[model samples]
Target: MKFKTLNKNSGKDKLHSNDVIADFLHEHLEEFGDPKEDILKALNYVFDRGGFILLGLENKEIVGAVVINDTGMSGYIPEHILVYIAVHHNQRGKGAGKKLMEGALKLCTGDVALHVEDNNPAKFLYEKVGFTNPYLEMRWKRKQ
Candidate 1:
């Protein structure tokens, strides 16, 4: 497997067309519904702000992708957040996700953060990559 960071301007399009990302999200819509508009918006926001997108490929085919943001929080402290990640179901358990995460970490200069649902198996992967759960507050409100 090979890991590569894609150009921010083109990453979103590549991800949207990737068989792995589209198929996995479609197959698991019960868990990650087909929120195409939302996903596109998130991708655009990341790219617009000089964020990073990493891709994991094998045989030139995309197996996984991760979107990260480098929010310059302060001198010596940039907040890196993994906004989205997906690995092909067929390619799961094959270390593709780990490679993608590692690639993202290489670009982060400070604290890194990501949100995983309580039931998301990917949490284990994050932990394995040296990310620890931090005590923090999060609140959500549905748009009116």
Candidate 2:
């Protein structure tokens, strides 16, 4: 598989288009996925806040993709948050996701963090990649 990263400085003629990347995530992520708009927003956020979107390609098709955003801080928080990662449904259990994650992690200068639903099998892969759950996440959403 070939890996390509798209960031703020990436040119217009990237190997894969943002639409392809967003569609791939929305499709492969299944029940754990967010809407395409949110994915697109995250993809755009990388360019605004300094991060990269990594794409895993094989046979000229996108087999997996990972979106990571630099949190712009360290010590008290991880320096990067892996926002999304997904491998094509037919490509699961074939190490494409792992390779994508590994490649994404390699691009980071400090600690990386990601959220996984408790029942999501991908949690195992995250743990295998050296991510530990050290705290329970609590959030307060503003009422609309």
TM-score of 2: 0.95
The parts of candidate 2 lying over 4 Å away from their true place are: 12-15
Top model number, lDDT: 2
Per-residue accuracy of model 2 over 17-136 as CA lDDT, tens digit each: 778788889999999999999998998888877889888888879988999998999999989999999998888998888898889999999999888999998999999898999999
Q: Please write out the lDDT profile of model 1 over residues 1-144, one tens digit for every residue.
A: 777665465554544453445454445333744476655555565667757667677787667777677676745544776777788788888877787788888877677766778688888988899977755748899999
- TM-score, one value per model: 0.76, 0.95
Model 1 superposed RMSD (Cα)? 3.5
Candidate 1 segments exceeding 4 Å error: 9-30, 75-78, 140-143
Instruction: After the best TM-score superposition of candidate 2, give how far the Cα of residue 139 lies from its true spot, in angstroms.
Output: 0.7
Q: Estimate the TM-score for candidate 1.
A: 0.76
